[model samples]
Target: MGASGPAVLIAGPTASGKTALAVGLAAALGGEVINADSMQVYRELSILTARPTAAEMGGVPHHLFGHVAAGELYTVARWLADAEAALADVRARGRRPILVGGTGLYFSALVRGFSTVPAVPDAVRARWRERGAEIGPAGLHAILAERDPAMAARLRPTDPQRLLRALEVLEATGRSLADWQQETTRPLLGAGAWSGIVLTPDRTALRARIARRFAAMAAAGGLEEAARLDALGLDPVLPSMRAIGVPEMIAAARGDRSADDAVAAAITATRQYAKRQETWFRNQFSDWFRVDPLAGEGAALATALGHFGAGAGGAAG
Candidate 1:
């Protein structure tokens, strides 16, 4: 944004040490850590989200971390708007802005821009979620299939989140989400504005990391955090509820599943989600350079920071 400043993005799968990499990079690059994580945005579930601790941040400024109440809904549009404001303010301060997280959708929204669809209300959402189960997601997929077969064709019947959202846009606004997306398309950061590094550890390593991290997290307050949020009883359809281990953990903590079963389910879910992220990155974030931390974590950080430095003087792409 200025003649000189850094706006860097560090992205990767869970347990890839993205938070440490981000903080270290931000500290080294004279940057503030701006959260790009979807779950970390919620105030009530820090441990479960693996949000950077205050001590971990090491006196560096962090923005949009635990700023929103969990009960409140968040959307890509709102996050984009918030990110826009944060970037402006960070640029004004003449400090680098380091964006980091594992939320692929958040990263995609930042790099490719997002549609500004209006808030889909709770009553409407409740009805849809209820209907989604009763009619089955396949039934909803059939409905979406009639409206926009192209989008529906790609979605699996079991992706209730996608199905519900597609239907919500159609029923609530009488316009398909795809149509709204087309009209609201905006370039992310104009053109060639920033640089990014995606931490791409080996597949086996990444899976082990996800599993081990979840296990450590479960020991280190993730279950408590999830239970606390679960007790709040917010809309079950909310995005946070579907966070990789939240549901399974919640059920496990409540004795619905054995601890072993819960762990396996969570790990399986996370790995599956990571696959989705990988596919998304391949398809959408084809421009980013990949960094394999397995080689050397420090080297990966250096490469990421170097990209930021290179792109700081250029306009956003």
Candidate 2:
């Protein structure tokens, strides 16, 4: 953004300690933190999403965190607009902006730009979820393959939500999802705009951490929270509504699974998400600096902090 702009960013899958790393880097670099996350924006879902706590924030200001109400679905375009404003403020105050989050799409939008992926109306989401129940996730995949075979070719066969969105976009706009995607041209960072890195912790360690975090969540009242949300009867397809553990916990609350079984399922789902995150950063951002969390992360991040003045390369997360 400026000659002296804060160039540091920390990103990784959930429970990889990206928040802790960001807070530490901000303290080290005289910077502030800006969220590049999706669910972390919603105030109501903070605890479930593992949002940075006041204690975790440690007096360093956090932007775009817990500012949105649960009901309002904020899109990536809105996130970019909001982040630009935050970056301006941070730079004005002579503070570096450290973007951190688990949402790869948000970070991708911050770097590679995104199109107006229409916010699927609640009715639209409901219809798809209902169809999914009747015909299964594979059914949604087939529907999308028929409408936008190109996009389908790139996605998992059972990614019901994405398949549904592609079909919805084609039906509603008379254009394929790939066409809108092709229109995406904004390099999110605006050409040499900011220095960034993805923290990819080891898979063995990441899976262990995910299991431990879910175990801790269970002990700390995840079940209770799930019970509370279950009473609301929100559609299962809403982004936050379908957070990693929600479905498992819901089934447990409904007596379809034991608490132990639910925890296992949630842990399994989180591990799956982490694997996707790993593959995403590895393939999509092969050029971006990476700091693996298991190794010399502190020094590696400090090196990344100098990216604005002097670019740094990979360091194990």
lDDT (tens digit, per residue) of candidate 2 on 1-317: 55445356567888887887788778877889999888888776665678788999999999999898655657778888998899888888888778898777777777677876655566765676688778877877887777678888977876666676777777667788888887774755665556667887778887898998899888878887778777776656666677788789878988899999999999999889888888887787676666776666476556555653364322211
Q: Over the stretch 108-171, how does candidate 1's per-residue lDDT look in tens digits?
A: 7776667777778878988888898688778998988998787797788877888889888777
Per-candidate TM-score against the hidden true structure = 0.90, 0.87
Model 1: ten consecutive residues of lowest lDDT: 308-317
Which ten residues in a row are the worst by lDDT in model 2?
A: 308-317
Q: Any residue pairs clashing in model 1, and if so which?
A: 191-316, 191-317, 192-315, 192-316, 192-317, 193-315, 193-316, 193-317
**Best candidate (score: TM-score):** 1
Q: Tally clashing residue pairs in candidate 2.
A: 7
> Candidate 1, which segments miss by more than 4 Å at Cα?
118-123, 306-317
